[model samples]
Target: MTVLLTIIVVALVGITFWQMSKILKLSQLKNVDTSQVANDKDNDTQGKLMLGFVIFIYVLTIYCFSAYNSFFLPESASKHGVEYDQLMLISLVIIMITQIITQGLLHYFTFKYRGKSTNKALFFADNDKLEFVWTIIPVIVLSALIIYGLFTWSDIMNIDEEDGDPLIIELYAYQFDWRARYGGEDNVLGKANVRFIEGVNTLGVDVSDSYGKDDKIVNELHLPVNRKVIFKMRSQDVLHSAYMPFFRAQMNVVPGMITEFSYTPTKTTEEMRNSEFMVEKVATINDIRREKSKALIAAGDEGLETYEFDYYLLCNKICGASHYNMQMKIVVEPEEDYNAWLKEQQTFGEQMSAQASN
Candidate 1:
């Protein structure tokens, strides 16, 4: 494909230079009309080129959709993500259809109406029917899309307590890493602030608050599959965005303030790893890694390790220099596994007491 594109570009440039040389030569001729106006042959050639370019556009569009379909993200892993994907698919389909119709008509008209000496152009000063059709069609389409999008957004954002007692977790963001603070047992995150940060109190939980005593902070985030998880996001310094791609959830983490996003995990990490799409993606990645490993080995460097599939929590905002490395592993497992893992982590009060004793 690259070679083909390069050849096409070179050919176009060569043709342009050739045409310029001909115009230069014509300009030097004595008593010649050197206005360089397009005649019937030039018009016919340009019309054919316009038709060919439109054909190329359609062909490229079809090729891209067929060839790169596998590169698209797999199915969503959150309950509300299904609706989000549906809305996106609908929007894309509408845009594609509109593009095809509009572009085809535009290029076809250019070719059909190519200038000729015998032809007389028809002029329309105004057409109310045409104006009304174009205006109303877009308004109707845009209105429908906007209304549907609003409903979907409302459903995702309105975190209702009636939708079962959600597992409340605080996602704390710092310069270049993420930390998850779980509300142990009480299922309530306590008030926290940067001023409270000291000793082992990394998340700045107000230790005096009874609700904060049992808050467990950890480097990794884990959630119970099929359970609704509400995340309260906070940033210590600069603004950050907590983005969970697989779950289709993202929210800004502002300094001195907290943002919220909630979603139910529909698939466990293990289940997602075993999915067909994931399996194929992993294999393709490993193949590329193995090829690169050979080069590293030849250069006396360590080979890359094999990769495993896992969901991740990442910073979407370019907060700082190491923004790319600002990510945490997220594990969605069965309820029992999640409970066992949470129980093993030391609470804030315990950590503080241990530090004092030391």
Candidate 2:
């Protein structure tokens, strides 16, 4: 397929060159009488060539834009991208139609008005009907698009409780780290603050509320597949942004207040983890020299393509100098495994708390 496309592109380019050569040849001819020039038919080939080139240009441009705009861009948190894309397409379509119509008309006029032996300029008065048609047509088309854009923008930006679940997750960003708090079994998040932070109190979660007992402060976020996730973002020290490229979501994480954004995670973190882990294992074993290879081979005789893990929480914001290093490994396991991990973290946190109090 690629080879075929390459050949076709080459052929078109060659044809373009051939047409340009003919246009130059025709242009070099000495100025003939206007009547004679208008009567000539060979010069028409140049106009056709110009039209073909314009079509080719539009095709290539549309192809590249569609490929990049649709497939290449990752998802973002802002409901902004979706509507923006639609608006862009609408605008392009309008422009293309205008260009084609105007260019065609201009070309036809150039041929019709070509100078002639007759010393007479046809005086055709402009019709108000034509003027009204042109003006009103654009106004109507633009108004329709503007209304549609506003509707899409409103739908995505306004969180619909009727559509999405109240599954809230508080995301806190530090200078060089990220922490997540799941609403635990109750699915109700507890209050949190930066003032309460101690050497070990990473999230500074205000556990004073009775509801805090069921609130789980998991360092990483574990999302179920095909579920809408609403992120409640906060920054402890500096300004930060919560950016999830895959979900096409982004929102600012400020210190004083909270910001929110939502998206559906169609792909599970487990899938992402396994994919990345497999690649890492391949790279890790590639550098093993013969001396160490013997030991590694003996330890795992089963051809070393063996590590797998789920995807993780990544902070795309620059909160501080070490912002680039802020990330937490996430595992999107089955509900059973996810629950088990939560239980383990809870027990461990409790143990640590007991030891510190003692």
Candidate 3:
């Protein structure tokens, strides 16, 4: 069936090219008035058609913005999320306004000045004042945007180590998996080297460093809601990005150096799951999965299981063949629950000391 479809498509393309060649050869007439080929009547009709198309573009933009906006990630779950959202909204509004004004004038002019045999063409020259006005307007607008962006960028990048008890966590990226390490009471991560990675030292914590002795390692990330969490990110072999869409957080993990990003979790996993937006999202996902499950069943494969809402830490960069599956679960809970879970995890020192006894 695929071969048959390919042959049909190829035949259609060949016919189209052959017809185009014939038309080009036939249209090579010398001293022919170009406007005669496109008559005034045809141009007028085309101008009206273009005007309709402009309206269609406007309608489509409105419809898409109204219907598809809900499909985007729900409100961000970080302390700076509101600021990020406001910045995005401001940019979108500016873009939309520019698009509407330009398109409206373009189509209106096309329709109003459609070709006519009796109409005389007007001689026009460049207007210095008009050019200056256009140039200065954009310069002023862009300057404001640049100034606003600079302040926002500076604030987000500046991390105050002395600020209120910010949890120090390391996000380790590898080929197909992710590992997280928590700094002990000192709230400082020990030095690590890629060479020291072995069976259990997946994150290559320097055992010699006292700061690494009590550092906890975990498969899943757990954070306390409303607590400032600073991630010290590292990569093993290649570049990877730690991206949490919900928190509006992303940072590249370079192989040789550690990168950091800090954000406070404003919502818990359960709170996000139960939110009105997430409830709708889960229902939509389930509906899609149900359709996929039917196709899998027909192919003699196991049907897909129902999906649930959860926060995820995902690799946003294309690092390896298994990059798509490089993800880890994230859970945000109250401070007490997070502390209890943190206590249950084994520390680097305990794990290594136990291995020596074995």
Candidate 4:
């Protein structure tokens, strides 16, 4: 019913606009094209009105979008989200204001000297004062914006772990799959290398290292609230990107050498419901979506929706045909729940290991 009503309303609006346009064409106020006739005082008013209307509409559109973004979206993520909003707002304001001033001046100049009676061209080719003023003003504004953006970017990327709780996780990516390996109860990641990769040991865990035994491969990651998580990202097959739009974080995952990036998750799954950007942000919904969106054939029974959750992972890079299948899930929990979840995952890995031996 809602869809039908919406379609009917849209059709009505479209017909009304079409009729109004046809009526306007019938009573057209034509502008004189010839230079002399175009410069006539009688036609100048129309040109000025057109310019004014254009400027007003352009500025109105930009500001309205900025207002909707800042106030409409709930405060979900911390500095990352808010800074992006503020940056977008400032950028829109700057662009719209500059465009209006430049365009308005151009239109104003067009009419200001459009008199046909003046036979000769103006003697002055360029005004030195005008040149200096415009050049210096733009340079100053551009410099300020660049410096401000750099500082904001630096602050967002800084994830120092001198005092507060910081968890280090290894994120591995391949042709079309993502995986996360938590450091486990010991809180130290076991060594991993591409050269050590075999069919069964996909992650290339260094079994020689005693610590490697306890280091578990959790399909879904559970992060503690408000804790800084530094992910050591590596690509096994091709280049991939680690993207978390909600946190305003993305890093390139290159093969051979490992790339690193970090973000502190502030909003929980319950809190994410209120965020406007959250709808577009995939990190929170990644695991859930992956489980729900899995093909019935690949995942066994077609009726099954939910699958196992593992450490948070995703393939942001379009590597190959199966790139669509690349995904991993994350579950952000309270400190106690995160710890309990970690322990349970470790237990499950041990059980699976024992079963394989039998």
RMSD of each: 7.5, 13.1, 5.4, 11.6
* Tens digit of per-residue lDDT, candidate 3, span 27-145: 88986565547888798999999899999999999899899987788988888877888888888899889999999999999999999999998977998999999999999998998
The lDDT leader among the candidates is: 1
Better of 3 and 4 by lDDT: 3
lDDT of 4 by residue, 202-301 (tens): 7877766666667767656667878888888888878888865556667899988888787777876546643455544444456666666566557675
Error of 2 at 328 (Å): 4.6
TM per candidate? 0.91, 0.58, 0.88, 0.69
Q: 167-248, model 1: which lDDT tens digit per residue?
A: 9999999999999999999988888999989888888899879998888999999999999998888999999999999999
The weakest ten consecutive residues by lDDT in model 2 span: 70-79
Q: Which residue pairs collide, candidate 1?
A: none
Give the clash total for candidate 1. Answer: 0
Candidate achieving higher lDDT, 1 or 2: 1
Candidate 3 weakest ten by summed lDDT: 30-39
**Runs in model 1 lying further than 4 Å from the true structure:** 1-33
- lDDT pick, better of 2 and 3: 3
Clash-forming residue pairs, model 3: none
Please say which candidate is ahead in TM-score: 1 or 2: 1
Clashing pairs in 2: 75-248, 76-248, 76-249, 77-248, 77-249, 77-250, 78-250, 273-310, 312-330
RMSD to native, candidate 1: 7.5
